[model samples]
Target: MSPSVTDHVVGRALSWADIPRLVELEGRLFADDAWSAPTWWAELAARPRRDYVALESDGELVGYAGLDLAGEVADVMTIAVAPEAQGRGLGGELLALMASRAREAGAAYLLLEVRDDNAGAKALYARAGFEVVTVRRRYYQPGDVDALVMRLRLRDERDGVGDTNG
Candidate 1:
């Protein structure tokens, strides 16, 4: 069953055990230069990725994303929605939920990297209040693909967001 309209989409916290699915999705989405299972293993084993969550729908894993909560900033270390799940608004929903989690952690801003050629993801971030802040060349090795750095400012209680102290 779906969450209530006011409840927002829910993502299941994933463990290293979910590595197989994560790696599989990464390969399907990134093709030849995908992040290996070990990369995700490292992420899952890390403290920050402990909060990473996978979005499930129709009893299947349709998307996955993570947040690294550092003192006052949250980083979107990795996020991927399965090919069959792309084009749906699920990515944007997952982003919004991640941003909300950052805010809940007292993070003032969120940062992430997106492949420069990913216009769809860029647009998704833009609509979510993120802006292109910088660019890193040859960030994706082997393919020499560039990465666009982006950030989103989290809304505070003063900004009419959920009460920071509440």
Candidate 2:
């Protein structure tokens, strides 16, 4: 089924104050590999190079995503939507926001890694024009799940053309 817009979802920059709630959400969403509060602090410490945005619905946090930029490349560090909020297009909206932010930061391509078993996330990335580049064997620990590396060539802000790096 096609995803539908989540009109109540609003996006905003994630800050230090949100770490506690983010940690709680992380535990709920990712039990084994959930990021620690200290890790989130360190990621936020990276400043303009690392950007994180949180999504809220009716004033309650429902999703969050992070991007790491370096020169012409941008990596989607993490993205998650609450169980109750999944399939409502919040993930795509956050991803698109990251892509726009990456393009504005002069990124030519955006990259991400997803577990092979995550068919939903893989489909989401595929629908967003991302192509699988390679697979890292046993990338996810504790379960030995393979990681599918995906890339999306962002449109050049100046020329309105996609970057020529596959």
Q: Give candidate 2 regions above 4 Å deviation.
A: 1-9, 156-166
Evaluate residue 161 in candidate 1 and report its C-alpha lDDT on the 0 to 100 scale: 67
| Leading candidate by lDDT | 2
- Per-candidate TM-score against the hidden true structure: 0.82, 0.89
Cα lDDT computed for each candidate against the true fold: 0.76, 0.86
The window of 10 residues in a row where model 1 has the poorest summed lDDT is 1-10
Instruction: After superposing candidate 1 on the true structure, give the runs of residues whose Cα lies further than 4 Å from its correct spot.
Output: 1-9, 48-50, 156-166
Candidate 2, residues 40-70: lDDT per residue as tens digits? 9999999788989889877888899999999
lDDT per residue, candidate 1, 68-137, as tens digits? Answer: 9886778997778887667667787788878888888878888999887778888988888788889899
Clashes of each: 0, 0
Candidate 2: lDDT over CA atoms? 0.86
Return the lDDT, model 1, position 1: 25
- Local distance difference test, candidate 1: 0.76
